[model samples]
Target: MLTKRLVTALLTAVTCTITTAAAVPAQAAASTAIPVPSTGEHLMPAGGVFEAGTAWKLDVRNAPLHANSAGMVKTVADQTAALYGGVAAFNAYQYSTSFYTVPADQPRVDVQWDNCQGKNYTPPGLLGPEGQFTQVPIPADAVPAKGTDSQLTVYSPSTDQLWEFWVTKKTADGSWSACWGGRIDGVSQSDGFFLDGFGASASGLSLAGGTIGIEDVRSGVIDHALALHMSAPGTWQEFSYPAQRSDGFDTSVNRVPEGTRLRLDPSVDVDALKMHPIAKMVAKAAQKYGFIVTDKAGCTAVVAESPQAEIAATGVDPWKQLMGSTPSYSIMKNFPWGQLQALPRDYAKRTVAPATPSTDPGTSPTAPTAVSTRYVSDTTFRTVRNGWGPVEKDRSNGESAAGDGRGLKIAGVSYAKGLGVHASSEVIVPVEGAKTFSAQVGVDGEVGTNGSVVFQVWNGATKLADSGTLRGGQAAKTLTADVTGASEIRLVVTDSGNGSAKDHADWANAKLLTPVATTTTAPTITAPTTTAPTAVSTRYVSDTTFRTVRNGWGPVEKDRSNGESAAGDGRGLKIAGVSYAKGLGVHASSEVIVPVEGAKTFSAQVGVDGEVGTNGSVVFQVWNGATKLADSGTLRGGQAAKTLTADVTGASEIRLVVTDSGNGRTADHADWADAKLLG
Candidate 1:
């Protein structure tokens, strides 16, 4: 989340159409450049604009491999010394394998690892012998009809190499294959090894719709790379093709915590959807068609009727119940559905149809027969046992039995007659021997007015405590009154002395005092703490530079106007007439640090306002003397915060500025803001 002031500032500064992108380099790949547009004569590299459906592939099968079974060991022994020396003798060959899917409906790509078999002592755990692989599949009934990609990068760690892959497209015969190739090889094989490489445009294959696969294919390469190294156990990671596909639990290594799930409030947050199109689609679908659980086998099971039959009995189209036309359901891996479980049949008068005998003979005749014998029962109740009741009931008119013996005012501005002030008048069951009262309060209005609603808990006639008014309608709060062994409880609402304005308060869900029986202590309450870095002194002059930086008013600085200096700094700065330049250079040698602790990221804003420029951008960087720490992003005139959130450790100096090294612009607007850290 961003701070209120920071959000406002960014929103104001970056009002023009802005675009962004991100890319990470691979150690074994060739240099890659963003393609720029061609002017009337000169051709320029693209800045950050990538065509929406552009595709690419990454091949992992062409890399190293091990075996899934042990029988292949003898085959390598026959020619172990012919290729290298004793190195290939005991090589399990299976230790360097990738996982691939053989689905029932699709042809699987055949991979050959010998293409990547090293001719020298490349040494396992040092560099990789992985290469790009592709083959058309032959249609055969014995082959699985379908296949999915698998994650093969997991083996790279054991092999002491960095590996990555992407599925690009299928051949006419349906064999899936990768399109890019790169490897970081020739290093000491050890744990925690790290390397960096760049994937050229050819290596930018997108994994958007592909799976990573691993297989055993090392017999031909066992003795090729070394003389005495032995193989180790090989493991492969799994990649689900459809982004929404889930197999029981995610196990993807990138899975979100089990307890925390993504939730978007549609009414107040529509922009979040734009960032995660797939998740937004799922959310919208969940809201439209009440969610159906996916089985352990990854199959979505349609819900014939809601577990809460009473709600289903309302004749509400489950699909139409969605806030919009989107469907929603809880995504659970271990959901239990042996027999249907529904709560007591309670109605909202208009919420559901009145209980009527099921015309179908199979509909239980015995259940209704038992209900006719009593208006209420003492034993535990189930949904089928209780019939739908009236929505309106006679509730105590602000009567109270508190120690003070005073009646509290219960009526107030409500959204509807049956709601709000009259919520208590609706049917409410007294929890036998309950000492507290609970109610669900919700608001739908701007933060200010929504935050002003006052909530209170009362015992009969006396006001025991004020639960505090709800200020925002976005979040829901459960208010409870503490009073042991009480027979009844009341909820009180006040408008804060304001008149006639109903902010759409919905009190449809309310219940009388009921305490959860527990001998254990109640959940502890704690407040979250926020931290900020302290301010630093010793400001340097001309310590900032960039391609450019701008604000809402216009360009703050264009090019490196401060001229040459021992260091990069810009304390007192002004803009130049140039629209874009090579880069912003600082005059002061010293660096300025921005505090960003307990924050997920840091972002910098640069460029001029109102005017568009070609190759115009602002990049935030952290440096340790001459060593660069991080490069945040290329800025656009009036662009939002593009944060640098990767791990930042042992960084001493930080700077913010802009540059247009790749392409030049003619607009005379640009400037920059110190990087802002966000949690």
Candidate 2:
């Protein structure tokens, strides 16, 4: 609607803005400088108000415009009226005017509404309650008025409520300015107008619903659909719904978005296009309810709502008597915005496709194996715009299971949501030229202290590999990259530090490792010498020697419930039943090669697995880098298993520290089964 609403208010973090401007003098505002509410107060909330509209009939309940089209709506309105030339460029007649009832001294000021909902909007900025958004006895100098992308409906039948406004200045610098409007209780509003679904304009929908407002030209007969307006907008998102392009389309894509409906050609013949009984009753409501391209002005227009709605419905002012009332703005000054017509918009009913995975997180055998040559699932990736489907698993908002688990999680990264907001996902590989793309990411639980989750890898736009920050559930970094043939590969996922709060994130077992060619021309014979890269040593477990561990949130790998090993780590192992924060949670850490003082003897097995002192256990310690040496004695949750020994004497580097046995972090998945240090 304006190139897709500043990219849908920066990916739904909505903010709008609009502040200063002037110019709205079209007469009205001298009833002795307006003013009448001496503490009467009741614009809305008496029953919510409604009624006061007059003279307007034809609306046989909707959906019925007979006469088949053999002319595909004037051949797409002559191919969009050949872009601004023919049909006199559909000029003038723009109005979003309103006033079901106004006279007690018109004006009514005192605004302030802005409901911004991006990442659910927070920090002292709701601006709703207080006076329900004033607007009572207005006129105060009629307010440095002006207009540009304007709208000012105003229903209030005592409270049936409907007061709409955008760029509605002079209502007395009240509050919720431009990116600030709303009140809507129900004048039907075609279903969505505010309450977040949006539509005070900028095409997220609703311009007095299907618009032609002035009670549809003294109810002459133009049932639904008729909101035309355009300075440019030829086509690229013919708008619908209360409008929704949060971002996209600027000097190009040629209009046709906002809530497009289009019509005309119920067999053409409107008295041979003689038009003008209000342009053939708005071309028979565009041959039965159709025209809706909503906005983008400066030239082609069709909005209206003033004339005090024909002096509050027929108190005379026959619109100065000729053939008009809401002052017909000179009855269609040559109407025909190029015969218009662009209907048939199925765009998958409204986008959201790529999400195939039935079993392939690349065969998830506890995850992590498919380094490519063929693997799939970046949720089956698909973005070059097709309506981003998969990566949306919202998890209500309390996220975990590594931030929204399964399907491409994107609830504002683990928490606070939206500062450096990011969430990518793609995959179209099979290039076969030069490859190497690995994955094992993490982040949806404890990174807390501040938060961090960066894990990039692009090929289309270049950026090769990143794993940089990472936290929640800690320990997970295998990211790799080297592409050459590149077919599309991507991943992105961000919130790098602090901002996106809890930073929920994960990508365990991700894969795409390809590079295996072989073929020598003219008679076999290969082997130029190569082989030297395999150093996999450093395995350690606890929870009593080796009850086998690895349960990421649920059923991770095996052994965890004997009432959560009821407090035991004494040589037989099995303690941590969830209490992980920094690095290892379901306990397990190692990096030995000691032998400094007495050669090595670190011993393990500790305790604390649930209630004894409530939920606290930290009998596990032994470091080298931030030096701690040895310590294991702090068990309560049921208690059992205890054997702590240390003798590296000089120590070189053999880390392991789980802490938080109580007081703060808990779900305690801490246990170090069979953790070694024998050297």
Candidate 3:
């Protein structure tokens, strides 16, 4: 129950702009001073006449309330409540037109009876034929009443169908008001009271149905009605109408204000919900809305991550969770969503390229005074090491081929002369400030005896950290260093003191990797080291030539069905299918890379124009040669985009390969765009 003052305050808050506020009071004063309408000569039509400045009030209520929760209070009394459950709002309706003429001597007023019960009440009732009117005899002693509910006798002067209404006195001023009462069961509504509000028209009404229509007396406009079918609970729906109907009571004119968030049902599926225009927008930004799962205890809901609490509180997915009646974000008019940036990568170094490569003599592979193809024995080489391995050599290469010509090779200079290791010996290569380092090294021939290897981080010429021994020969050895900030690092083979007769020392894949950097700035693509890429035959693929190409910049790599070669400069490779391939889509461990400075996030945009296959994705990843920098998972043309970020230390090769997940579906035709590395 609300008091008049409370209702007034609520109304003021809800409707701030109403013109002519004091007009109602002033008009009421003037209307109270006028004579009653009993003596008027002309009578207006039943549904369309106005009793100026007069006000009518009605109270409607519904019965019975059951408390669903333990502490909730009961409000509704029993079935005795006036309104069955109907909400208060006036409605006026037109029945039939008729006229009433009052005689001068009787000092009477003409009151027309318009059957407000719509078409249901036939001619026998007040909705009778023409020449009939409901004329109410006013008491001479009544004090110029502006509102009265006295029964009236009406007379109609026309032959057309006549209507009836309990017409009241006219206010001195022009405005008029009317109210109606109807009961509805099971519906909930406020205890409504109306001092001044008019009713209007309706639709889907017929004389055969039990629908009633009420109209504004002054304007003869049908204002409101009671639809008997809506008397049952849950049978009626609330609707807002904005325009003036025949009854003149058009109530739904206000627009929804800003900061209004409508919550929709949570059970909706994404694809199905997209059919609705609003739902589609929310799905597009699902990532921006994260969900935090928790139990009643306010703990991390995960079993092992944190201790399980009795009451875990977590954030629900805002986009999926409905807050009120609609699924919409309550964004302020000035809020900025378009200005935020997306981040994808996790590394900082640029690309993956070897520190130096085997090249033609007269070429400055290291300190190039000129360019030339130079051949030197393996004895004069230094090995580049992987900063990550346990060396995992037993898996691929046998013990004999382990550490064989597989480590990093620094071209041009002879390690034999630079660091002074005996031909049959090994020494430590030092890298300073390196917390840890890993590398793969190879011994060209056999190391029958004195097979020894040393790895260390160095400051220029001093060894800061070292790995004491390495089993030699074609085997690969992994080395890690914990020292930090070393200006120079080397992996040296001291004395092959065992003298196993291993001749040359060769190194291939080397990684000088560092931890992921923390920065917000996005990385930019550098101008390529080579001229604009030109299509070339496979025979010319050299370390120098390959180093110049940008990752994700080459031609599309279509799946093998097109007979496209994967061995060339990596031009024209398109993915025929995409699914869960072993290294990328299939397994979480697989990675891809993009050539850019610093750590960057990588996304694979798989384009599928309705094609199908199991090998439909192109994995855009960066790697320090054999070591992966970063990798993203399977992306279908249907899915279109997926992103993963990794850290890169220096120049690295980014490889996109499509491996079939073996789903055996006609692989989807997938195209890939260059990877976008976000910050």
lDDT of each prediction vs. the true structure? 0.24, 0.39, 0.24
Model 1 residue runs over 4 Å out of place are: 1-428, 431-487, 490-591, 594-616, 626-679
Q: Tell me, by TM-score, which candidate is best.
A: 2
Off by over 4 Å in 3: 1-437, 446-468, 472-474, 496-504, 514-679
RMSD of each candidate relative to the true structure = 32.0, 28.8, 42.0
lDDT of 1 by residue, 1-679 (tens): 0001110122212211122211211111211221111110000001000111111011111212121111222222222222222211110111111211111223424432221222111112122223323322212322111112111221111121223232223346744333222232311111111211111011121111111010001000010001111111001111111011111223322221111111112232422323222123323322221111111211112111111111222332222222122111111111211111111111001111223222122121112100011111121212111011212211112112212211111111111111233122212234465443433344432222332455555566777655344433223333334455655444445554553244333332243322232223579755456665554332112232222223222222222222111111111122222222222323212124343334444443333322221323444455434656566555553454343433434443344433443344323233433333434
TM-score (C-alpha) between model 3 and the true structure: 0.19
* Predicted candidate 3 versus true structure: per-residue lDDT over 1-679, tens digit per residue: 0001111132222211123232222111111121111112122211111111000000001111111211110111110022312111111101111123222123333333333333221222121232122233222222121112211112221111222222233344422211111111110111111101111112111111111111012111221211211111110111111110111111221111110111112233444431222223222222222111100111001011000010111222211221122211111111112221211110011122223222212111111111111111212334343322212221211133333323222111111111212233332333323333333333422233223444444545666444344434222332333335654454544434554333334332233333332234678856679886543221111111122232222222221112111111111222322321101111111223334444234344443322222234433344566776554444553454444444433544454444333442233333433233333
The candidate with the higher TM-score, 1 or 2, is 2
Q: What is the lDDT of residue 600 in candidate 2?
A: 59
User: What's the lDDT for candidate 2?
Assistant: 0.39
Q: Among all windows of ten consecutive residues in candidate 1, which has the lowest summed lDDT?
A: 214-223
Please give the distance, in angstroms, between residue 212's alpha carbon in candidate 2 and its true position after superposition: 3.9
For every model in order, what is the number of clashing pairs? 101, 79, 187
